[model samples]
Target: MSRPSENGLSSETLFFTATWNGDSTRCVARLAPAVEAVPVFPAYDLRAQFEIMRLAREKAGIPAPRTLWFEPDPAPLGTPFFVMERADGQVPPDVMPYTFGGWLHDASPAEQRRLQDASVGILAALHQTAFTAEELAPLGEAGLRAHVAAQRAYYAWAHGRRPIPLLERAFAWLEEHWPDEPGPDVLSWGDARIGNMMFRDFTPVAVLDWEMAAVGPRELDLSWMIFLHRFFQDITTGAGLPGLPGFMRREDVCATYRELTGYEPRDLDFYELYAALRHGIIMARVWQRRIHFGEQPMPDDPDDLVLHRATIEELLAGYEPAS
Candidate 1:
């Protein structure tokens, strides 16, 4: 907490890694409650976020950052924050998008697959991990129901001030085709894309981001794994560049996960749409945040905020978009 660089004034600091001076032991700090400067509905709660990560580390045997300390009061920092020992390794870069070019691109196909398999393997481990009522108490008891409910809430919140019709249609589609019985409810690594993982030597050393972590069917995470990579791949493929083709194909990831956990991934068609819906809602908020910070102007199309607009529509129409 004594890091001078991080002590400077700021309305909100969502996440940053701090290195101790003595031994240079690095730890990540996650601050909560969107600053008034960049408002988003359903402000993140420090306690709930803390519990998720703590439970994942202690109970799930997942490679999560070590939950070091949590400060609820805003006195020490402008907002409530929690610190965890920073997991080592490089995250596939966001700007270049690993699919396009970066360290991942420089690596051989086999090494990239090693990282991809390890990433899915971590997801398998999470799905296979069980939890008692007490361990899951902090996240609420909605179980699988909680997944849809949260997205519905997010859609409503994002549209309250800024309506995106594409998001509306996607939400409606999800509601109509909602699975009656979505198999077994397990711990879903809610934000389950490879982007959330840290890899060293083409292997996931740490799994980051648990704010979206929830208890849901395996499909939620599995579908997200496919959809997110496909999004990036679509971009690169559109540019006529060879993207991360072998990274996270639907069959390959599902097969690897199945091999590890002995559970066949199902209902991915529905879940991928769900993933787009979820990502679309978050993207809308992100654009709203950009507008709030005066960093970017509002676009002509509300769907502009949603990155995979064309893909979402195609999926809704019962067709896989060309990726």
Candidate 2:
């Protein structure tokens, strides 16, 4: 629904400003309609997304973009959209990935450590935020069981006709190795990754993108943060570039998280694998969109559509504890 604007990138989100009295007053994000035939995830709700952002900023004390208003009527823009205050800062680029070489990669070890710790602190704070049962109702159910159920629904929606065998096997693996006792759930910033955050002075100024926001185990967010960085690092290294290899290592993230919040991180391997599975579903949907638009051809093997098919293969090959 949102068109290309001078302020922001051309994606499901757009940025614009209100000009009054010959001066621009404030910048706002128009959470636009997704062009895909169906959302990457089946549970895409605008009201829930808006309320999640609002609660993260106000209730949880996390640095999230403040949502101003929502217009449910699609008559104005052909689709319902919500306007949110824009946060200004640098985003670690996905195209040239920070690990490939960027301000984050160029920073000193201490600065990198500071950034990593503060980012994890966002998770700690959000997980610690106390909310009423009424507020939690709209959000996804607690723990990994609910997450698996939702993902099953998503994969079902995403993989209707041309099925991806790799994803099916990954689901089977998850069922076989389900954790004995999953941790308690919290207000997980569903899309918890550095690229979703705007950073100033290596600290998170604002957290953006809460469409994936839900109530799940703390590892849901922590593992996502860890996996995304590893994904970038893998891409960087694959291209024969020295990436931020030591940055955001799983052990380091776990240690930092444990120190910040008294809760010790548990079942990280399970969660990181889960993160990869979730991301694989998203990437597969992206490929489907690309194929629909003639951006790319459908591969002979559907698993090739998944960028990290190897990750799924390796994950399925065995389950190992982090050293």
Candidate 3:
């Protein structure tokens, strides 16, 4: 096992990678210590959230990080951090190696179909598994509502400050098209996506990043995944693959989800539109953080800027007049 490297502040508090001793080899662990340094409002106590998720995973028979240790504050290690048993797999979001380019670049329709199936299957299993709402009662309905409101407010503030027309439009759309009946409440992984899961040999090995995990409408999770694909579609055409692997068509995703879970999909258009707006808002905040911290230069990616702008326009276009 690789010896533990000397621990110290190296990067942003929410995320950092470090090598640590494993049973037989050095294992690299990514740490999301807390939100102590971020400018956003605290959603939940990071330590507590991790504990809840860990317990939830065990109860549901889901493969998640086994929490080795954790603390509420920066006492033991000068920061709130948790250690978990690292699993072996590749995160789909990272840059794919050249060797992977063959299948990635020239993927047959059949192969693409398989990838989509796996993504849907994993999410279905996640939502279908049992985990009592009572266990998550600490984050009450009000708390969940506040979480969504906070996100909306944060984006609106960003839009007002920057006066991005597209963002303003997206906000308007979201307000108009909010779901009428958002289905049964379930544990929603706030940021559900293929990028968040680790896969080995094209199969999911572990689902990571439960920092934003909470109890909410089941459709919230589904919408997030569907919107993620749409977000990517906005950025590029068929010329070159982006950093993340493209899954099957969005229709296929929704169909597969319905087949696996026995719940008919609803308001896909509204949800997808909401997803795009949500993502744009989140990215805006991320950009704001980078500028506030002077961590790096403001993004210069024209594609990203346009995509966010376009998402806003799309949102506005989908807005319905109030009765």
Highest TM-score scorer: 2
lDDT of 1 by residue, 198-218 (tens): 888887778877777777788
lDDT minimum window of 10 residues, candidate 2: 1-10
Error of 3 at 310 (Å): 1.2
lDDT of 3 at 293: 87
List the global CA lDDT of all models: 0.77, 0.81, 0.60
lDDT of 3 by residue, 228-309 (tens): 7656554544436563344545677778988999987777666666667667766666566666688766555422433366
Model 2, 46-157: lDDT tens digits are 7778888888789888899878888788788776778877778878878778898879888999999989999999999999999877887778577778788988888888
Clash number for model 3?
0
Best lDDT among the predictions, by candidate number: 2
Off by over 4 Å in 1: 1-24, 319-323
Which residue pairs overlap in candidate 3's backbone? Answer: none
Q: Whose TM-score is higher: candidate 1's or candidate 2's?
A: 2
Give the Cα error of residue 172 in candidate 2, in Å: 0.7
- Which model is ahead, 2 or 3, in terms of TM-score? 2
> Alpha-carbon error at 258 in model 3, in Å?
1.1
Cα RMSDs, all models: 4.0, 3.0, 5.6
